[model samples]
Each structure stands twice: as C-alpha cells, then as structure tokens.
Target: MFLDNEDKISIDRVVEELENRPELQHVYLHKLFKRDHHKGQRYHEKQISLYAEYDRPNLLPFLRDSTHCPLEKALEICQQRNFVEETVYLPSRMGNSHSALKMIMEELQDVDKAIEFAKEQDDGELWEDLILYSIDKPPFITGLLNNIGTHVDPILLIHRIKEGMEIPNLRDSLVKILQDYNLQILLREGCKKILVADSLSLLKKMHRTQMKGVLVDEENICESCLSPILPSDASKSFSVVVFHCRHMFHRECLPVSNTVSSVQFCNICSAKHRGPGSAVLEMKK
Candidate 1:
C-alpha cells in the first residue's frame, strides 16, 4: 500500500481545466494565486507552464509578483510567443539587464523607452550602451539630445553623432539644453541666497533674545541647589545662570567643565540635547 500527496493531482486537474477553457483562466488563476499562495513549487510551476503556452494578457503580471516561478523557463516561453515586453522585463528582473536593454534598442527600436529604462535603472554602463545604440540612428540621436543636461550630458552624445547625419530639431534641442543649464544655475543661486538670509535672520533673532534681561528677584530660586537665588542680607552677593527656558541655578551649584566651548545643558529644560539634562555651566554673573 502507498500514499501520495494531493497537491499534484489537484494542480494537474486545475491546469487541464484552465487549458480546456481559456475564457475562465484569469478568474481561476486569480483564485489559485490568492487561496493557494503558499501551495509550494508545484503550484508556481503550473502557473509558469500555463503562462508560456497561452497568451493570457494578465499572466506576466502575476508571474512578475510570484518569486516561486522559474525565470529561465518563463523567459523561454515568453520569447517563443513573441511576448516582447515580457522577455525584456524578465531578463532585467533576472539581473541580465544588458540583454534586456539590447532587446529594447535593437528588437523594439523604441529610443524613448530605451532611454527611460536606462534612466530608471540609473546605471552608467546602461547609459553608455544606449548612447552607442543611438549613435547610428538620427531620430534616436535627436531623442537623446532633448534629454541633455537632465538624464545625460550633451558632450557625450554630440561627439558620437555621425558627421553627415541630420538630426531632427537639432537647433531646438541645443537651445533647450542651454536653457535648462541656465535655469539650474539660477535655481542654485536663489537657494544659496535664501539659505544665507535665513541663517543671518536667525542669528539676529538669537542675539536679541540673549540681550533681553531676565527678572531675577527675591522670589527666584535655584533649580539645581533648590535654595534662594538672592539672599535676604544686603551685604552678600552671589552669581547665577538663567536659561532661555527660565531655569536658574547658582554658579557654584552647576558642574565645572575643562573645555571653554563645551555646551552648558540646563538640568531642567533640555528637549534637544537628550540625556537627563546634566547641570548647566555658569553663563551669567
């Protein structure tokens, strides 16, 4: 007596039903994907096989999301079926980006798409490959020229252009590139001015705040020592430091630092410096 797994029989039956009724493949496939998401490798293999044999429009998108599908097997079927987009996407997803980019350049002959794919990947080698492919085609050359100063440099593409070839909208593309460069320079200058002005304005505001006197009367008490900041006797006088947060401490009650420029953190109000607010240094006398 022998026992066998049920998944194989179930998947085989589902595949046959899907193959026999092409109209309901997507619905059943969606159900299979959702209900049996973790139905193991057997489930994914069935999906891959169905996608390769039939031109189910929604097949690749499902395959794209499933990591269980064998990429090499899927690509082979997609290529045979003339599924150009799938072939390109599958190779790229499999890390064979050079092959995918080649198909986009030679097989698809779509200059804009090839450039956009290169930009999205943001690979220098891909840009070089695109530039080399575009060199011989005047229309491709024109398309790349329009993207200069943004996705690519004009010098790189311009020197590659054939001497006798006439590119479409050549003068207009150059003008646009120059305008883009000028606009970028102006933007940088404006940003610099705004940043500097903001810095100066903040500094001036901080100076004014520092100049404003704090009311240190007999009612005031030291936050650190928890004693009267000003003694009732008129003959004696002591120093104190007052923070912008209005926390006061006696000069001798706070910790002493060896570094002259070390930050003085208030023991009370310190929302920025983290820690449990170490004792503040003597800032006022």
Candidate 2:
C-alpha cells in the first residue's frame, strides 16, 4: 500500500504500517520515540526488545532523547554499551550537565573522575557543591583537597561554610581543609616575593651598567662641535667630560645645563653619564 506524504498521518496508522514490515519497525519506532517519548518508550521496551542486541546503539539515542528515561537508566545503558562519554545529555535535567556527571561519578565512588570533572568545569559554585557534599567523607575530602584545592579558590568555599556553619559537626574537618588552603596561598605569595626580588636585583645590575663610565678611546670625539679630544691636552684649561660609552666632549662644549652632574646624558651617544667624578660634581653642587 502506498502511504500518503501528509502531516495528518495518525501515530496508530504509522505503527500499523511498521507492524506489517518488521524490518522497518525499529526505524519507525525510533522516529516515533523522537516525536512522543512516553508512548515510544513503551513500544521500545515491549516490541523493540526482540532486536535489542543488534539495535541497542539505535535505541540509545532514543533513550537519550526520551524525557521519561531516568538518569539512572540512561547511565546503566551507557555503562552496558560503554557510551558514557558519547552521551552528552546523560545528566538529564536535574542539574548542570557537568555537575550531574560529577554526581554520577561520585555515586560510582570514582573520586578521581569526579575531581577531574569538577576541575574541567572550573566553576567555583560547582566545586563548592562538591566540597559541601563530600565534607562528611574524610577520604573523599582529603583526595579533593590534595588534587584540586590549589587549583580552585578555597577562600570562597571557606567563606560559604563560615556563613552557614550548618555542618558544625564537621568543624574540625573543615578547619583542616582551611589549613591546607592557607598553606597553598602562603606558597604562592612566597613565590611571587621571590620573583619580585630577583627582578629588582636584575634591574639594579642593568642600571649600574648603564651609568658606569669608560675611558675615552682614540676614535672618541666631541659630537656637539665635532672637535677632537686629545689625551695630551687632558691637563689643559679646557676640561673634558668622558661619557659612559667613551665619547668625550669639552665641558664647555657640552649641552647648556645648570651643572656637570645636571648633564645626566652624553652629548655623543646619548648614554647616561656617570662616574666617581660625576658624584664629586654632584657633591660640589
């Protein structure tokens, strides 16, 4: 019989057509499952059970889409078919998907998996939820703090716990968790201080190098007036100023400034000028 391509086709007629052809039963049922989860699931559980082993993979998608399918049931299917990672909506609508996966991992008593999921999410609120839920379980708390405490901000969680204080029974355990958090913070600050000190030391060394003066060489000449500074005329009335780069210029030929020390830069290379004599000049000022 030819089927009309009409939108008004009843679900009963569609099912009857698939019933006449057993080969198309799973495919049509899956389509119906996608359309109406409640009825489709009922048919899937009853009629689809015959081809379940061969058609399980096809059935998983329908189960994943079915609102009637409980998270526990979906998880069981995932475990049986090893499709946990493949099913994106395995958590259902109870909570955030990642948080729900974390809960599932926790239920399975897979602490590492739950911690890894929590870290991947990088949500402070989710981490806090995991912390609050696992508080009474000392072993789980220890593992969480050891693995992820440094990666997340414990201060926020601590503040939350302090505000509520509902779980006063676990106060000592909470205090221990805070101690680990404080230790992590202290180590981080210590590292920053060390980095700052090293940076300052390196900067001081660079400054000293930039300010150190060198003796004038044969090629050294005054840049301002293009005059040669002769070593034989060193004792002459014309005073010479040797810059950090060995570029020499007559003091009178230097840039017009208040004092020699005030002339903080070279007239030749523009390098900063400094020496024992520059300090003496500053003292004279």
Candidate 3:
C-alpha cells in the first residue's frame, strides 16, 4: 500500500496495510503476545484473540491519550505500594508494548514507573501535582499554606462536605494542623499560588547553610508581640501580620484597639507602626 505523509490512517487503511504486507503479521502477533513472568509461558491464546478485535493502529493515539482513569488507579496502587497488582490490572494503550517492555527491562521502582507512565501518557503535569500533594513534604506543605491562607477554612469545608467526621472536632483539628505545619492540602485543580512575601521568606530560609541543628526543629517565636512564643495547641492556624521592620504579631493576637487606626501598638517592642497588614501564615510543627 502506498502511504502519503498527510493521509489520515483509519482502521480500513490499517487492515489493508496488514493484509498486503506479510511481515506486519509478525508485528501484530508480537503486540498481542502476553508472557507469564513466573512460569515462563504465554497467557491463554484467547487473550491475543480478544486483543485482535480492537488492534486498529489508528486507535492507539486515542487510547493512549484517554488514560486518566487507569492513571488514577495506578497512582492509588503505587501509593499503597502494590506494584504487582497495578502492573497486572492497570489498563493502558501501550500494555506490554515495546515501550512497556523497555520499562520492564529497566526494572524501575513503583514511583519511578509512575513517573515514567506519566511521561509516556503525556499526563506528567497532573500526576506530578498529585504526587506533590500526596507526599507529605513539610516545607512544601508549609509554603503552600503561607501562600493561599486558605487551608484552615477549605479543609474544614471539605470535611463538612464529606460528613463522616464531627464538625466541631474536625474544625479544631484542621485549625491546629494549619497552625503547626501550615500544611495545605491543595484544593485548587491545576494551579498553585502563595503570598510573595511568605515565599521569599521560605526561599531565604532554605538557602541558609549554617544551621546548627536539625532543619525542622520548631523554634518558639510568638507571632504577636514578637515575644518568645510558647508551644500551644490553641495557637494553631492563627494568622499573623509581619512588618517590613521584622516586627510580627497574630492578627487576632493584636489588641482590638489597633483596628481603630492604621497605627497599631506592637505587643513585643510596644512600637507604633503604620501600613497595611502583611498576613503571615504560621507553620509551627
């Protein structure tokens, strides 16, 4: 069959090509072959017969692109550390194809395989974002909350929506989580945003190389009054306002008198400052 670069290949064209070229029969058979890894034998001959019905070359692109459901299942299985079940049951366009064969040869770990699957399926961005949320990274978690300041409220809302937990207790628990870790379970679909000031502070802190202790050791610094804050569960998820002068205080920690005018008394140094509040999201734990 004479093929043109611009011609769209359909199932009819694929059938014509396969019938005309005897060599393609081997390629078709190779694509459908399923080997039993443990016993070193092939699966039932029916598996190939079943696959042959839908083996149109033109359908491969669509099948590969429409892999979100299996991708999600694979992610869940990977997170649960069930690689065998995932590899065996998870469906994809390139099932045991040359690319999958290469991946199998590499003998990659589950997470690595997930990453490769994401790349191969062209869903790397989505899977990567999900992995970031699923994996608990303290700094990334804290940084996320510091940006949006939406964790406490949104988490409480989600819990309420789920309706499987006590509202009051869950609200309190979420508040505490927000306060200690600034842990943000990302609710946004595809994009992440955080406060510029908070991000810069985190960046500066991360670049510091002269630390004398463990990186995540919590230092008790009071948000309000800039005083040496004590560890308190009640103080969790409370928003703070930091000044350009490095002065900081809890938005709620400040006296109600401060709201009457732009100038507010600093609880720590008792200094008067003027400017809009610079919201500080705290990550205590």
Find the candidate with the highest TM-score and give its number. Answer: 1
* Candidate 1 structure quality by residue, lDDT tens digits, 129-239: 888888988898888888746867778988877788888899998998899889889999999999999999998897677557778888989887789887778577677
Runs off by more than 4 Å, candidate 2: 1-111, 117-148, 159-173, 185-213, 223-238, 243-249, 258-263, 266-285
TM-score of candidate 1 relative to the true fold: 0.65
> What does the lDDT come to for candidate 3?
0.40
Q: Per-residue alpha-carbon lDDT of model 2 for 1-285, expressed as tens digits?
A: 212333577556777776757657666666556555766555555433433444666655655465565556555555566555534345634456564656455556766767776777677776777777776665565566556656776554445434443443355655667787788789999999999999999989976875665655446566667766544554554466655455556667766752346446764455664455542122100
Residue 239 displacement in candidate 2 (angstroms): 3.0
Superior candidate under TM-score, 2 versus 3: 2
lDDT of each: 0.73, 0.58, 0.40
Query: What is residue 168's positional error in candidate 1, in angstroms?
Result: 2.7
C-alpha RMSD in Å of predicted model 2 compared with the true structure? 14.1
Per-residue error for 76 in candidate 1, Å, reads: 1.8
lDDT for 205 in candidate 3 is: 78
What does the lDDT read for residue 72 in candidate 1?
A: 84
Error of 2 at 117 (Å): 5.5
Ranking by TM-score: 1, 2, 3
Give one clash count per candidate, in the order shown: 0, 0, 9
